[model samples]
Target chain A: MRPDTPKVLFGIAGQLIMQIMPEVRTPIAGQTLTLSAALLSMVAQEFDRAASRLVEENRSVRTLLAASRDTVSEQALRSRIDAETADMHEHDFHVSALQAVNDRLRSLLIDVHAAVETTPGEAAAGLNERIWDELKESTRRRHLASGLA
Target chain B: MEPELAKYLTSKIPGSTGMAISNVFRIPGGASRETWMFDAAWEENGESRSEAFILRKDPPASLLASQRELEYAFYRAFEDSGVPVPRMRWIENGSEALGAPFFIMERILGCDSNTTRIQDAEYAPVRDAIARRMYEIMAEIHDFDWKGTAIEEVLAPPAPGECWKRELDHWEQVINENELSPQPIARAAIRWLRANPPPPPDRVTVVHADYRVGNFLYTVKGIHGVVDWEMAHLGDPLEDLAWSFMEAWEWTRDGRKGGIIWAEDAIRIYEEASGTKVNREALHWWDVFGSVKGQAIWLTGARSFQDGKTAELMMPFTSYWLINFQDEIMLRAMGRGA
Candidate 1:
């Protein structure tokens, strides 16, 4: 099959579906087709960015973790951040590895979040604000056009 | 004999020849009972007559302590009291034919239960007023004295400070058993709840645990009735009030309390009609607790769907649709990292 054959076939099938189940006569069927189309659209988007988004986000979190070395007072956490900072970014980093890192960072982010919530001082406040901004921005990058960002 | 049901219905409804029941269908409303909506016919006096009614059968998953008979009694107590409740016709506890205890009642007449479309302009113009009326009626329910009704007889007497504990423990146990996801937010809220417990209830009253905009029937005139009394029990009345106003049911996203009426307006109407003041802090406490309870439900739905325990429409939809929203609610409620 040609590279674009799947797209052409999906479009043809979708048109047939809509013609047989117009919204006025069959709203549920029509809605189902529309949702299927949307799901396929998401599949296409994900196909293009599946790895890139993970790579970008993993790098961002690693960057933030390194940046935290100056702010975190706990020697253990600081040393972990320092080691993670020294780690080289690898192209061979698989999707699962990136996601695994993401999960660790996210869980650690919660700890960082809870710690900052209890702590005071401008450094803690500023660090907390930066973490919030990163979380917000990360959500923005992942926002679906169909949803509220 | 679905013998208990046949005997119970026959004795109460005086009839004659051809008074035989068949094709009994016990539908699932298992949290409350095995609800059977079926047909009955008989010769009353001399004429042949028929009617469609509901049967409530007690099951193992009694979410609360209230008996099926008490629900029937409450329904009977309020049949013609302008409460828009179903006409509860019969109650049968002896299990013989159906294999479980059950009751029969006149099924409510309305569209399928849904609040998702209540906000559409087709239903919206009357939606606000209907919501207001529903809140007012709920206040009337909150004020309905257990002392004067059969509710107190079936429900346990309230303790001085155990209402919150009872509710929290029940819902938390459900989550512990049924949760499909790691609920960091609910876990944190449970901790906060235990640490800063709400004060003892001003009054213990019957709580409809699943009260919300969706579990009701409304028309252009106003709310016709509040249905689905499956999770009814005794608790702090404010728990009912807060559950009704929980934020997850905010289908309209216009600050409409439970997608029905505005929070302030609903509370005002409730207070005016019930003659009972709602404490803002306690209600807020119940509101967060309501979110936790809702998470438990969504969690249960996911577990049931996965375990093939129920084939209901909502089981998968709860996990696919509302689990994330429940997390979002937990985030907002706890005022953590949002």
Candidate 2:
């Protein structure tokens, strides 16, 4: 916390690439060092925003689930929608806690999205479009500027 | 490891004595295997001999569980053909000598396989020639007849109609087994693929599943050796073409496939060499399928690392760098990208 996690990570990554990598004798070892540096750089980026991103995504997906409650034809899926969106507030703010909740919410979102695709109605179509928008947004939230692709 | 390799080579090459292995070092970018390069020297009938060789050994766990023998057979199939490949030397499947199943081949020296190497200005002069030859070699691969050869014996030919289904099923199963979290985009792509299957190819041909720029050995002259045949199989030929056109391998992010040639020119070269008319719709379907398959691979690597099956940093590196990026590529391929 004193030096800031990102600052420390970036410093180490720079050393690994600029100093350590060139000294590595074996090609595979050099590659490992390079990848370790890259991973550290990416982890630094993720560390600064992990909690906020997960929380924002969780809230967004919950809203979609709540809106799709009626559009989903399956009773089981509807029940899941109601259960997941009941509180709509994250009580636990730990990154792991937030990530666990995000996983469940996204899993439920997939089922709801799949169901609405075949439901055959104007309501389903509108919700389907919204779900696609959220899916696109999910990528934007996870996109790393340093990503290789 | 060097001593073990020397002993193995002694046994494989009869009448050889004082076998020695030097320059033993692993190379980067073989995420699916541990690839090492070295020089082997020995005396046979009082004559000293030396050669550069490549050793591909199985890691504890990797992105895919490919069979070494199948890969070896595929390489053997292309021997003496127009498709340039390294000469196979020996294969040891028992793991008794190398600590893992491994195959040795003659190394194609003085050629680079780095994806970004071609993007440099120095390579600009021969970029077009290399790109044209790359697709031409791909055409030669598809035109090759595998009947009664090692490829046919090792791999079962999928019916033309079942090619898309077979591949989609395999990759979807890979996702089901390896995904750490929900993949709604990939799942949606899978559903669309199932609902609208591409019309079967005119005939099943060899599909180099990972045929991309990074997989080949190239130089200012041209591509010399096309490596990485672990995923080779009998399938629709368009699968290889579309996969070559995927955005993930666009190293420059400049829309040039493989950072060398445009899709239009690549397609035209492939058509001229193989004499098969391009089917735009079917190729589009395979392009989308390629992204899902790419996502499945990255997910497998992530799960492998998460499950403690591998300590290789590339696994996690690939997961972080490619998983979400592949999702965006898939969305664009399916006409849903913003």
The best candidate by lDDT is 2
Q: How many Å off is the CA of A46 in candidate 1?
A: 8.8
lDDT of 1 by residue, B1-338 (tens): 44555565677775544556665654433343555666667887788887777776665443333456656666655666656777776665777646767777786655545667676778767776777788778877766666766666666766849999998998999888986544545665776788778888777766766778877766676776666776677788888888877667777677777776778888898888888888888887888898888888878777876777654433554454555566566656666435
What candidate 1 gets wrong by more than 4 Å, as runs, is: A1-149, B1-37, B55-82, B89-103, B110-113, B116-128, B148-150, B157-161, B191-199, B258-260, B334-338
Return the clash pairs for model 1, or none: none
Candidate 2: misplaced stretches above 4 Å?
none
DockQ (C-alpha based) per candidate is 0.10, 0.83
Clashing pairs in 2: none
Candidate 2: CAPRI quality band: high
- TM-scores for every candidate against the unseen true structure: 0.69, 0.98
Q: Quote the true-contact fraction of every model.
A: 0.00, 0.83
Interface RMSD to the true structure, each candidate: 6.5, 1.0
Model 1, span A1-149: residue lDDT tens = 56564475456546756664564344334544554555454445445565788778667778877776777777777776776668748455676676676666665665555566456788888877676666655544454443211
Local distance difference test, each candidate: 0.67, 0.93
Q: Say which candidate scores most in TM-score.
A: 2
